[model samples]
Target: MAETRIRIGIHQEVRHPYITHNLVGVTFSSLQVIHSPPTKMAETRIRIGILGCANIARKVSRAMLLSPNTTISAIGSRSLEKAIAFASENHFPESTKKYGSYEAVLDDPDVDAVYVPLPTSLHLRWAVLAAEKKKHVLLEKPVALDVGELDRILEACESSGVQFMDATMWMHHPRTAKMKEVLSDPHRFGQLKSVHSTFSYVGEGDFLQNDIRVNPSLDSLGVLGDAGWYSIRAILWAYDYELPKTVTAIGDPEYNESGVILSCGASLNWKENGKVATFYCSFYTNLTMDITVLGTKGSLRVHDFVIPFNENVGPFYAVANSRWKELSLGCEPEPSEFKITTVLPQEALMVQEFGRLVQGINGGEAKPEKKWPTISRKTQAVIDAVVASIKNGFKPVEVVY
Candidate 1:
């Protein structure tokens, strides 16, 4: 394992309209087949040990059960009975093991990776432990409460040669790429100028009292941490991770009883690129979540951020700017028309890709893929800035990542 450092070209100049185009070009084009050294290729199938029986683990476990190359061979929780129950219900193999604590999972010789869906404050601790044991990690969303924790996780993973990834499945889906393509067309959406994104749902009785999501002492571990991270990342993906120099955020009238923002609105100013992004995330709103990118000629409407619902099941739709306002009106049969595709569930895609990486696909330098940590860190930077803005009465804040 070696120390890893990222160098950002702050002096580089890029226009707003070309940001998304350049990202796709650079990422997809430069994607070389990374292969691990011959010694590491022999170990395949990538055995995974889950840290907890958290609710989100349901989707992840199901995806693992369906994936042919990955296996959920073990599970751990504070309660051994709970761990055994989860393993039994999920049909773990007869040889599958159960543990009463998370550390045991990291110590398991057969476990090559650990999935951490723990509270925000616990991510760094467990992630570091998993890495120290030379185990790869697939952590849940937000990665950490703030950028400092993100840095520590990256440092630990880099120093330990573990495959560390912040679970953001949206980018793995074909629909996301297609959305970018449809939005790129000048005829459909001329020069882009503005964009808006949101991810929200009712979370009234779901959170536990002691859950880190509601525990302010843990810091920045609430709605913004829970769902705002995604909305912010979508913006960064659209803008090519070119962080805004100034940001203003407000969280009120939509926060939970605990004062954690249930709904938040943020505005960003990236002057060099002449781009602006406005995002809102909440847990108090009606069942509504979507992202719309506004361009000079047209607009792209992403119907659902988490998962597509119906015939039009992707995250975005491109509509001519001329017709966008008309559709927004009471006009019958909205003007925007387009095709739809499903973003293959991210959990499955991530597992499949990681399995290949472990099989030594890309350089297998024992380093986590560049994109995973880059975006994770950028998202945390935005989250920290937004939280600061709210605490300062929506004062404009600069995000440096």
Candidate 2:
């Protein structure tokens, strides 16, 4: 058997008023053994194009550069000058192409995949178009305004035989995989009892009034689609994408004058197993991102689940068979904290994973992976159910898969 090893280098330089300048470099490597000989080795890197100049695209652009299996092939915007400026600001390679319109990027034969960071309303149109052009689609989260729209995008990808995956970076984090391993262990975690998640941030002044998230025509679902997406995804992931039987809006959701949701909460129930999940999302609260899962024998808690406070390391807490001390003053077994460190950030891992799948398809070794799009549909279905419940006077709405 032949062995293949990949090494990634991460460099960091810090300068502070109280301390002298410092420089640090770290190298991380992964090794895989292949039974096939060297003659069977195929190209692995996937060329990626960007469809918009959204702020979030900046982070993904960096990820594409950092990922060993991906590269920034091109960037497109409505205005040619804007695309040029974005490329320059992001320090894109001189060979990276710039187009005046997204269609041009999609038309480029060299582009094997595209990262769509367009608004939620435009997802159905642009994402479908990208797929129809036979370009793999890496879409931003809050995939669509509703399941119907998401279905259209998914159908296009399926018909075109292009891979489709929503950009949920945290799901690719090493810590997330570690946590899932613990949850799947029957002796350690037991049956799931309940899960609670919250993702919120205070947005005032211009953000509440002028941000695209609060605009009715832009991101109509607003915070529910923005911040709430992560919370809902966490619950679904913890339960392994099992669709809940019923979804009910917890209370009256606060909305802007244009009826854009600003803050909201929902409860999901699995009647068959008596499992319940609750989540709260807001654009009008102190910044907080948390997920707490309680099982019969163990509990797991993670803060900064969406975006880790420190990019290099992700931390989570877990405890099994914890017992109260005498007079309930303290606990007998303290919760243990686990940290997973990575040379690349979570977003880079996401791009690397996406690239691996695309490379497999390009090599004719496999078909497009369906796992990502399947989970994406399940998440959007729950979001749709919650929205229906909120519209129906906070009544319980059945989640009809």
Candidate 3:
């Protein structure tokens, strides 16, 4: 059977109906098409180009190759030699094109999408440009420096009719969904009361001095945007993506001489019913990513909410409606430990999910899923509120949205 390629914009060239082959470089079971036409068996893959050779790009590049319907068709860097080295060091296919400039990747008709792991400061410029070029975008978070900047990127994607997603790995983990199921159970968890989250890891001396995250001009939001984003997003996810009524800085944020945040904590309150959440993100501590949530009848706890200790399996604890024992020495039932397993890493899952959406858009079977970007905006809005609170002498700042 001759391959029929349908080009959507200058990016996508999708095969109709059946999906054969792994689509990824690996040989695996064929993926069944979600919208199979009454035609023949055919496989579809999304050809992704990568912008920049940032360190995080290495992991995402691997993920793109692992995703069943995604491939790294090209990669670009300011230096042609650097791009060539990065592609080789990351083990990209020999056929993968290496360009000296990001624009070349965007201009490549074979590239259906682009994963941008550039510094946070550069997100707005490149993301908007990628969208305008009709390439689906997988951007690194915090998606923008502020909500206003983020809106521009979103608008560009909307105008060009392309998919947009921020890279937040934990959100795609199976363990996240499992934990949510328990948290959402009315009888088990009841109404949410409070949540506390933290994401912290001590950076090496050199890292603190030289990392982009600690650089004011490159990453002004610093730890708040880097490590804090995960904790904040986790809090928002627990609240069903609802914005807090007010966001207040709990203490003075630690900052370097450059005025970039190094450590910070914030409290989010839904003042009406007195629900509250607190989170801390730091670059001066041991590795930790924790989320603890309490409700009227139950609670949830995850030790590694950002990155599981084990890559293959993740465990979370949940206790629903536990009653005190006669002596009050021990609870009636211990919190049930649920361990979710995954064959692939969470980052791979994220890439796979993004590829699926791109595929649907390519086939005209579906529109871009708004949920991802919506939550991203909410997360950024909350961050903005936190910054405002920090600037206003740690006073509570009302969250507009």
Best by TM-score: 2
Clashing pairs in 2: none
Models ranked on lDDT: 2, 3, 1
lDDT of the candidates, in the order given: 0.70, 0.86, 0.85
Residue-level error in angstroms, candidate 2, position 249:
0.4
- 126 Cα displacement, candidate 1 (Å): 0.3
Poorest 10 consecutive residues by lDDT, candidate 1: 14-23
How much is the lDDT of residue 262 in candidate 2? 95
lDDT of 3 at 50: 93
Q: Write the per-residue lDDT of candidate 2 for residues 1-401, one digit (tens) a residue.
A: 11123433332211111111111121113222121212332444588999999999999999998887788888999999999999999999787899999999999987899999998989999999999999999999889999989999999999998899999999988778878977887777889989999999999779999998999888999999999999999999999999899999987899999999999999999996679999999998999999999999889999999999998778888777778999999985666666677778999989988987887777777788999999999999988998999989999999977
Candidate 2 deviant stretches above 4 angstroms: 1-41
Rank order (by TM-score, best first): 2, 3, 1
Superior by lDDT: candidate 2 or candidate 3: 2
Off by over 4 Å in 1: 1-43, 206-212, 217-220, 251-258, 310-315, 321-344, 361-367
